[model samples]
Target chain A: MPAPKKFSRDQLASAALELADEKGLDALSMRALAARLGTGPMTLYNYVDGRDELESLVIEAVVRHAAYPPRPAADWREEVRTLAESYWTTIRRHPQVVPLIVARRTTDEPTLEFGERMLEALARSGRSGRELLVAFRLVVGFIIGFAQGEAGAQAFSPAGGTADEVIQRGRTLPAERYPRVVEIATASARGDRAEEFRAGLDLLVAGLSAGARPASA
Target chain B: MPAPKKFSRDQLASAALELADEKGLDALSMRALAARLGTGPMTLYNYVDGRDELESLVIEAVVRHAAYPPRPAADWREEVRTLAESYWTTIRRHPQVVPLIVARRTTDEPTLEFGERMLEALARSGRSGRELLVAFRLVVGFIIGFAQGEAGAQAFSPAGGTADEVIQRGRTLPAERYPRVVEIATASARGDRAEEFRAGLDLLVAGLSAGARPASA
Candidate 1:
């Protein structure tokens, strides 16, 4: 009975992103998004065809807003690291969208644009052909994978403490059976997600630096 | 009605895994698993507590049977590679379970046992404390993350071909806008997934080797 809301495509996506962020990805449906927008499911169709379109909209909104540096750094490594950190910070804020982003392949303008910048940074390292593709994928994989790894660690931290806490409780396990686990857990009771993420990123960057030579020194 | 079918714990897990393998993870439910087993939902309760147990069972079954080398390789890098490949091959077979395994946290005996071996291999590199933990997590993350990336590529490959097909399609984009993407797509139309996977793994191993030093060496 009320007047229908006139929402732009970005507005629709922003609302959908908000829903997924607050309630988790599963809760983002046509009806739910419409209700959030103060509209009806039928009205929702005026924008998106269905779940696929809704998902794409949310994905684009997330990737588009990533705070890429104003320009690429002179050093390819720094460029890759800066761009990667930008992506990590963006996706980390919306944990619910992590799995969705990982699983759903999108050719949306925002994602493609991000990829172009990323590949451009890697190419600066003198990587060509498959090596370049592999490096690019490696960086992308690490960003998403590390996030998933952190999530898994949190899930395993039954007491809702740091991952080391999981290892701490795990210390009760017979040491003979899990010597390395106990040792690491005892030594690593302190945990920092960001530090750990950076450490892994450093390993990849260091490896890329060592393995692939620049076209000319 | 026919009498209820008798199944062991492993049998129950196997059937659930099969259901997930055939019908995707969403198809894995108490009722669906029960139906797969020629039983009723109530009967499934006798085996698994519910969805969580069912998921745990599937993950364990997949991880338990990984073809880990009989003894740790002489070189720590080789040891890590062997274990990671074992995990990669095992999980790659059951593509549906990749996300489930990545997302779910578990301390079941088999999963713990696998972790113990992995950490042991990593510890051999003299990466103690948090460094060891990060390295272990990096390998785990790479395995899962790389698989997710491959799946993403496949999903985006709308023509039902290799990931290059997706790139081929994108070649139509204005060259100036997607110069790097188009260049990579043009030079690298030949896709080899395993080769690409190994290439990424090589980067990680190379990174691990360069970053960590043995206490003795």
Candidate 2:
């Protein structure tokens, strides 16, 4: 009899990703993944070394989905904004995968493409050496962190009730104790996530522009 | 014989946190946690509802540990910087648990205290209403995102042989394909974490000040 056909790495990773999206990351165990693929748990190792590699594949696939029109040869600020927004969009789609992206160590071709494009944009900005990289990281950090918070609160924000009632309850927060928090967080939670992201993005770009601009610019 | 005594919720949460920190978040299952506590899994439920409540306790304790000296009555910029730094420190110590903090729906008392203090500081900056919250979220997003990147790179940055050799490998990239990234990401990987954070923080404060900041200051 012919040897049993095996799943490709991408196929396995895709299935795993689907499993994660459908069930949850906790449910994506080896046996569960094998069952999703119609294979034996022991046989699944033929494609993947184990869970760690599996997660890396999922992150790579997820990152690939976050598409942006390449302003790569254009202005540095716009390029950075586009890249950050794309990444932010990815986080919004697969919020569960944010931690996995942050946790995985390996860099695949697709993920590296995003980095390559981003770095090229930063280069056009006149930032070089450590500054360019630091800028890249700083922008990315803000985007991911903000997106995670947004995703985390989703189950509660719109999940709990309408924004008006939510704001009303939040507004009633004790003024004497957490005056700043009562007003700020309550109001903050009320605003739009995309608007906040764009506004913040503008600030970073402006600040970064001022900090790194060469004589020519 | 007398009835079996029970563990306190805090004690069980603490144990769960320890298990998560020691092994990994995935290892902190109900069965495993009960095993760690030297009690039956069913018995473990007496102190906690189940895995969900256990995770909450762990997140609460993790937030509590990310404490600062509380410059609550201090400068707005300084307060934002302090709170971000403390949160960063916590992520560093317990990188594994960052997801739990983000994933948890309800904000516990300790986490709110940090927020209360941060908002108070943001308020002192003459930003209020929604602007105050947007500012708060932006700063936080940057901090958390940066910390996640830092934590993610740990298994490689200091994990690989030496920084010099790693940079040498990084520098080997073709001068034409990615001169900017080669120079930047390579050098960024070499800088101290705190320095990068502070530098990024300054850029953000400057940008934010240039934006929503009041003219009086």
Q: In angstroms, how far off is B176's CA in candidate 1?
A: 3.6
Model 2, residue A2: distance off in Å is 8.4
Q: At residue B173, give the lDDT of candidate 2.
A: 61
Clashing residue pairs in candidate 1 are: none
Q: Which stretches of candidate 1 lie above 4 Å from their native place?
A: A1-5, A157-175, A182-189, B1-5, B157-175, B183-189, B214-217
**Per-residue lDDT of A44-95 in model 1, one digit per residue for the tens?**
7887777777888898888888878788888888888888888888877787
Total clashes for model 2? 2
lDDT of 2 by residue, A53-128 (tens): 7777787778778787844635667778888887787757875665555444434656656777887776666767
Instruction: Please tell me which predicted candidate would have the highest TM-score against the true structure.
Output: 1
Q: RMSD for each model, in Å, please?
A: 3.8, 4.5
